[model samples]
Target chain A: MKAAIFEHAGKMVVEDVAKPQIQAPDDVLIKVIRTCVCGSDLWSYKEGDHKQAHSMNDGHEALGIIEEVGEGITDLKVGDFVIAPFTHGCGQCAGCKDGFDGTCDNHPAPTNWGGGYQAQYIRFHYANWALIKVPGKPEDYSEEMMKSLLTLADVMATGYHAAFCARVKKGDKVVVIGDGAVGQSAVIAAKMMGASRIVLMSRHEDRQKLALESGATDIVEERGEEGIAKVREILGGPADAALECVGKQAAFEQAVGVLRSGGRLGYVGVPHEDNLNLWELFSHNIQVAGGSASVTTHVKNVLLDAVLKGEINPGRVFTQTYSLDEIDQAYKDMADRKTIKSYVIVD
Target chain B: MKAAIFEHAGKMVVEDVAKPQIQAPDDVLIKVIRTCVCGSDLWSYKEGDHKQAHSMNDGHEALGIIEEVGEGITDLKVGDFVIAPFTHGCGQCAGCKDGFDGTCDNHPAPTNWGGGYQAQYIRFHYANWALIKVPGKPEDYSEEMMKSLLTLADVMATGYHAAFCARVKKGDKVVVIGDGAVGQSAVIAAKMMGASRIVLMSRHEDRQKLALESGATDIVEERGEEGIAKVREILGGPADAALECVGKQAAFEQAVGVLRSGGRLGYVGVPHEDNLNLWELFSHNIQVAGGSASVTTHVKNVLLDAVLKGEINPGRVFTQTYSLDEIDQAYKDMADRKTIKSYVIVD
Candidate 1:
């Protein structure tokens, strides 16, 4: 099986790797259909440090067809199409029951699916809890629809989690920071959650267009204080809620600055800063929420319906596509900021 | 008139001074019946530096008789018993209307009541909005009850604000990180909100007793990791919500450490650290909230009912009282941690 491996910093190679096998009763084997590059992967790719090098499988998002299932799996069957969340969890744990699968207690060790999804086939643990079965036949959906479904595996679900954490409500003035895929998805999520006004802070025209199409009513292209100033001018004051999709310090600060006193901020960005000025949050009575999303079966199920109904087209975030052999180019284009997100198709 | 003045960093004197006059249309002159030393005041007191000297009247919390009212003040009358919140706001601003007086946009230039409350007479700005009428004659209530009403001016209201910001739901396991007046009040607030279990982190036996009396079901006497360890041992895991009442880094860290994954924290401490590790909060899916409490009339009114009904006794936090002449001793005792809180009676 050809799989993407992190060979060294800034480099990835598709080489023949042993296919995954089901070791647990709840395990299921899936043939990868589609996967993509996430912004977070750039952290290790850009660092180029040996200690940060990851030899394990690369991707955390994938939509695939079930090839085999272990005896413990009662709900899912072979030949079914399913989407896997970035993190896997045992459905029976207290944490999982409470809808925080990211911190599932039963599978205490690293429980992410054994083989990365950017491959010919992958082994998934806790099949029933970790996998969301897509209802329709794979051949019935168009290529764009398929890509949209693939987003439910990570980015779309994560964006929705941000909105959920921020408690985005109807009539809320929402400010979304970042123009990346997740940020675009957040624009769509904020709209879906009935936010009255959506503001996207982006410097790029292309991403800004996508942001508008995704439901942003306004855009603040300026960076830093200028960006905050522009947003304030547009909203007349700070927004009621802010969704921070870029995990950088400046982006977080901007998000905080654009929120009204007592407003809530939901952040899903992988933070690059070690410290946050809590005093700022304290003085303004702001609430900060959102972390590594634990998109439970509930969130996936709701998003799956929205995708099938064509209510949202998150797949537009994938600006380019590549084959398994062109994995290097796929990552390079994403890391170079040439693409919002790049997709990899495998069979 | 005699008033407490911060002459030097560590010294205070009760000397003859001009009585405060009503400067604004909404200003009201009040005969301060009770004023208490706050933990936050210790910041300046302990600094003992010439640069930190504040010659203004030395207290924020006070419950007194309304001696006079400006033309604009319609609701409050002379002889009415009232308590003033530490921060004042014009009731008309968007922030104030929305119940966040701390960030009120109008009348924004250092709107804290002009001269502090540790005096025979104090001038209060935004009198109608900042002062909560205690709804009875001063002579009608007992001294202890009057002291408890004074708590509504700052400590009790702040504690309630923490609980409100943390969204303490019924049956929640709450952890309070400080055992001072505000922390003790948080214990009472959590119980009032129907928290199933309340844990107080305190080293002093007296504070622990007050904590238990105030509604804390458990106490962790150790500090730092050891304190967290003791709490974990008791709870078997993290708590559902945590209240950070102490502003130091260690206290904040301990509060964060004790919250369960996806738990919420409300903090009232004046943060001493410039930075907070958002990474820790993000990884655990924790939500952080709280600010300088802007106790609106609504909150004060509700708390006033609780106090009048004998449902809560926040005044117990004040262990000692001093006359205006002994104001210096009051500050020293509180600064040395000899008393949980000190009160000053001026007539």
Candidate 2:
């Protein structure tokens, strides 16, 4: 099996690795069909000096076909197409039952194969619960549809989680910070959730255009207070909800700043700083919510059907694509902000 | 007019002050009938070195009779009994219309008379909206009802806001941190909102008794991790909602600690510290909300009707009473933790 390995900061390699084997009764092995470079992966790629060089798994998102099913897996079988949630859920824990499988207490540990789904073959523990089976094998979907389906594993669902956490509802005015793939996806989510107006904050023209097409009603190129003022100007007042897709401190503050008093903010950028001011949130009465997305729950409940029905085209976020051999370059493009998201065709 | 004056930290006096006159077209004069010493007032009483001596007006809560109506006041008449929310709101503003009158955009400034509702007579600004009519003069109600009505101005409504912000619902397990009057009031609010299990964290015997009587199903006498442990033991898991009625960082953290993954928390304590860690909240998916209570909205809509119907008894939190001349003692008792809440009778 060939997998992308993190050798150190600013360096990665695609090398032959041991194929993952089913170690648990509920486990299943999947051949990776599609994967992508996430914004979060850049955290270690750019400045992970404290991290052990080459000891961590590289990817969490993947669309795959089951090559082998363990004896305990009753609901799925070999050759079935599937989408794997970034964090596998056992489906029976209290967190899973409550539709927050991202915090599933009984979730199986990451595979001991020394790599992740960015590989040719990966093991999925508790396959019966976490894997969302597509109606057919990977070859049945168009290239565009495949890219969209692959996002259900994490990015699209994560974007949807932002809106869900912020309590975005019909006729709302929303401001989405960070025009990366997740933020663009949030624009689509806000539209699906019936936001009356959507504002995407972006400095890049390409990302801004995609966001507008995806349902952003407006765009602000400014940053900080100027950015907040622009959003308010466009919406005629502070927004009803703010989706913080960038984890930087400035983006977090801007999300808080653009919200109306007694407003709501959902953040999913994966915190790079820890300077939250409770006093500001207290005085403004802003409801703050967001975390790792409940990918499995969102996929099984809402997104899978929406994707199959063509209600959303989240695959448009994949502005660049690469072969599995180009995985290292994929990380570089994503890290340099040259690509909104890098899609890798692993098969 | 006799009013409570803050001379300095640990020093307060009852002195004759110039009577407040209608300085704004929207103001109304009220003869104070009942007021209470709040937990927040003690912040200045114990450690207010930076404050100018004798500069700050003391109280914010009052049940009173309208003494004089300003020229602009139309809905309220002179001699009508009313409850004045601590923060007066203009009825027509966006915040008021949205039912968050505490953040009303057009709220009138504090009266210029240099005194507050702890006085014999006080001014009610934004009279048409923020003042809730009691349907009769103060003489029409008994001492018990009067005490309860006074709470609607701030304490009881604030407690309700905690529950409201936390989204407390039927059959939910709730944890309430703080043993003050507002916290006890929160226990009542949790019950009213249909939380099946209410855990009140209080080491104080008097406050615990009052909270238990007010609808707390269990009491956790411990603090920190132990308090959280006890709450889990009582509820069999982390709580579905947490009401942070004390504004200290420890109280805030405990509120966060007791909540289940994806739980909600509402905080109303005037924050004495500012050390909220967004990382913890983000990871656990805890929705943090709350600020100054929308007192006028709660009093006008839900609480007034509930109080009038005898469906709640929030006045039980008033464990001590004093005449207007004993105002300084009222502060001392509340500050010393010798009283749950101190009630002041005025005319």
Candidate 3:
């Protein structure tokens, strides 16, 4: 089977790898239809690499068709188009029952035997609970719809998690830190939740335009304290809620800095720097929340219906697309700041 | 005027100080009827002192009578008894408008010219917004009621702030991670918010008893990892919400550790240690919030009514009392852990 393997920093190669097989009764083999290069992928793409020699492919989001299902699966079957959330849960663990499937006690990410979703064939564990079955086969949706569906697996749902955790509500003034796909998606989510003003921090013109179209009411091209001042100036004060989609230290500071005294912050950026100052949040009466996105929960409960109804076009975040053979270029384009997100059609 | 001054480490002296006068149009002279030794006061009492040769009194909580109202005062009048929240706000700033008067922009605590409330007479600034009227004279209420009213000024309201920030909804399994007056108050607040189970972390029999009486359903005496294990054992899993009242690093870790994957933590302890690890919170999907209590907001909107109706007995937290002359003993006893809280009588 062909899969995109992380060769090293500054390198991603599509090469032959062993085809994945179901090892558990609850598992299913998914033939990938669409996947993408995540902003998080840039972490390994630039500094370190997740894979050593002959290691599995590395990706987390996927939209695919089930090619085979194990006997223990009760609700789903083969040939069904589905959206596979990056983190699969057993659906019965305490974390799962409490609506945090991303942290399922029975199936932590490290225990998964399946290779990454940036592959032609991948085994999805806990298929019965983790996979959200689409309404029809792959031919039922257009390329744009397929892209949106793929995002529901991770990015779009993650964006929604930020807004949801921040408790964004009607008439709220929102500040989104980061202009990546996830940040753009957060602007959409905040708008959907009735935020009166949405400010996107972006210096890039293309990303800024997409964000504005998605729901951002304003934009700040500045960074650091200057950026915070701009947000406050635009809002006439501090914002009600801040969505942190970049994991950098400055992003965290910017997110915390632009909020009002009793404001809330929802951070989705995978923390690469330990820079969150509890003292700041404490003294200012700020509420801080958000971890790994509860992808399956949001996808099944919100994103699916919204996407099906065309209420949101999160797929617009993918400004570039690639074929399986062009996987290296996809990573390069994103790492070089040439694309908002790289959509990969792998079927 | 007589006031309690921090002479040095392990010493408190009640000495003559200049009588306070209304310096601001929004200020009033308060003839303090009751004040108390706060746990926070011990911060200065043990390691350092807050006063030099003739510094103002060292206390924040006060139940008093308005002896003279400023020309700008609108609602309060002379001779009216009131509960003066430790932190006063202008009531019109963005912080106050957002229900966070504790962090009011126009009148941060450093701008306060009034001596501390541990004096016979002190100036209460932002009088119209910060002082909550008691509906009658100080003598109209019993000694116990006065103690409870004094608690409303800071301790009780702070505990309520922990619970409020934790979002302790009905039927929640809660963990109160401190056995002091604030923790006891948090237990009461959690109960009022309809928590099904309240677990208090305490080693002291007296505080444990008080907590149980105040609505704590369980008590974990162990500290650190053992404490978290004990709480999980009692609750059958991690808690839904945790109230960190001690503000120590271990307390924050314990509060965060014993919570379920998506649990909420409300921390009220003045952070003496910068120990909040954002990575831990990020990985666990936990929400952290709380700050200095919004004393004025809580006193007016909830505590006053509850205390007046005899629905709560926060005064029970003050197990010992001392006269103005015995102010030194009050700090000594509390510092030695001889009292849950120390109540001082003045007029």
Candidate 4:
């Protein structure tokens, strides 16, 4: 089998690797069909040790067709098309039952059993909880529709989680920071939740256009104080809520700064800083919520319907696609900010 | 005139000072009838410079009788009795109108014109915005009732702000960290909001008793992991919400640790730490809210009615009282943790 292995900082390679097999009773062996490079993958690509002599898994988002199912599986069968979220959960845990599947008590942390999504084959444990089956046959959907459906696994779900956790309601003036794919998804999520207006902070011309298409009513090209100033000037006041998709300190500060007093700030970014000043947030009466998204079967189902109905086209976030052999170039393009997100078609 | 001055760390003195007079068009000169020491004031007393030559104002929670009013004053008369919150806000500002009085754009920060509530006479700026009328003549209420009413200015209001911001609904299992006056006030606030069970973390017998009297149904004296263990053991699981009344890092961590997934943590204590771990908070989907309480005219009015109706007795938090001459003793006793809170009867 061919798999994408993270060789070291600024380096990735597609090489022959052992194929995955079902180990757990509920495990499902899937033939990888499509996977994409996430912004978070850039963190390890930029700083991981180059001389560590270790090859690690390369992706967390992917979709595939089930090739085999373990004995315990009941709801799903062979050849089912399913999407795998960035992280998996056990379906029966209290956390999973309550919709926080990301923090499932049964599978508390990410394990290294399955190499990565950018592989030809992978074994997924807790298949019943981790895999969301697509409703129709693969032949029923166009390539564009399939791409949009794939986003329900992580990016779109993450974006929706931000709006959901912040409780974005109708008539809310929302500000989404970051021009990344997830940020674009948040703009759509805010709109889906009936936010009256969405201010997207994106400096790039390409992302700004996508943001507007994703339901952003306004775009602020400035960053930091200048960006916040532009947003406030456009809105004539602070936004009722802000979704921080960039985990940098300055981005977090800007997100909080542009919010009205008592406004909610929902963040889905993997934080890069050790701490955020609680004093600043405290003085303004801002509430901070949202962590790693708990995208369960329910959230995926809703988003899948929206994608199928063409209400939201999150697939636009994937601006570039590459074959498994071009994996290194895909990583380089995403890391270099030359693309919003890169898709790796592995089938 | 006489006032309590913060001379240095661990030093306070009541000395002769210039009497206050109206300086602004909206200022009002008031004779401070009652004042109480706040937990926040202890920070300056314990760590302030020892060799600093200048003395500073020391109290922010007080009630008084209006002695004079500026030309702009209309709704309040010279003989009206009122209580001043620790901070003031312009009633016309968007922040204030939204119930975030602490972050009022017109008056964004706390000012020093009043020279602290320990003074015999203090000039309050933004008189209409800073002061809340007691709704009756001074002679009509007992000293105890006045003391209780004073808590509406800060402690009780702060406690209520925590529960309010956390959105404590009926039947919630609430855990309050810290047994200080504000924490005790939170216990009362949670109960008033109809929480099914209130768990108070207090080690001292006196504070525990006060917490129980204030509506705490259970007490967990253990601190840190032990404390969390006991709480979970008692509740059969993590609490639905937690009120962090203590500003220490461990206290905040404990509050977040004891909450169930998706639980809310409302904090009113002035944070002593620079940052809270976003990683831990993100994983659990816990929402953190409550800052320097924006207890506006609306919140105060509602709490005042509750206090007046004998629905809650926040005044009991004032465990001891002292005259202006004994101001130093009051500071020493509070710094030494001998009293939950101290009151100064300036009249």
DockQ of each: 0.56, 0.51, 0.60, 0.53
TM-score of the first chain alone, every candidate? 0.95, 0.95, 0.96, 0.95
Q: Report fnat in order of the candidates.
A: 0.66, 0.49, 0.62, 0.65
Report the C-alpha lDDT of model 4 over B206-238, residue by residue, as the tens digit: 999988877899999898999999999999888
At residue B240, what lDDT does model 2 achieve? 87
lDDT of 1 by residue, B1-347 (tens): 88888878788888788888989899899888888888887777778533445576448888888888999998999989888778786777556666667655565563333346788888888888777887768889898998888898889988987898898989888999888999999999999999999999988999999999888999888888999888878987778899999888898899888876678899998887767888788877788988877776435657888989999999999999999889889999988878899988876
Model 1, which residues run further than 4 Å from truth? Answer: A49-54, A70-72, A91-98, A105-115, B49-51, B105-115
Cα lDDT, all candidates: 0.83, 0.84, 0.86, 0.82
Candidate 1 achieves a global lDDT of: 0.83
Arrange candidates, best TM-score first. Answer: 3, 2, 1, 4
lDDT of 2 by residue, B261-345 (tens): 6788999997778767877877667788898788878888899999988899999888899998898899999899888899998
Instruction: List, residue by residue over A1-347, the lDDT tens digit for candidate 4.
Output: 99888888888888898888888889999888888888887788888823353475658787888899999998899989888777676767555665766656566454212238888888888887678898767777888887897787788988988888778999899999988989999999999999999999887899999998878999988888999999999998888899999888888999998987678899988788758898888877888987777766535657877887899899989989899889889999988888899988986
Clash totals, every prediction: 1, 0, 0, 0
User: Could you tell me which 10 consecutive residues in candidate 4 chain B have the lowest summed lDDT?
Assistant: B106-115
True lDDT of residue A264, candidate 3 = 92
lDDT of 1 by residue, A170-258 (tens): 98999999889999999999999999899998878899999888899998888888888898899888788999998998989999888
Compute the lDDT of residue A319 as modeled in candidate 2: 84
lDDT of 2 by residue, A64-166 (tens): 8899999999999898989977766678855567676665545434211113778898888778888899997677789999989988988899899899999
RMSD of each: 2.4, 2.4, 1.9, 2.7
What TM-score would each prediction reach against the true structure? Answer: 0.95, 0.96, 0.97, 0.93
Highest TM-score scorer: 3
Docking category of candidate 4: medium
lDDT of 2: 0.84
TM-score of 3: 0.97
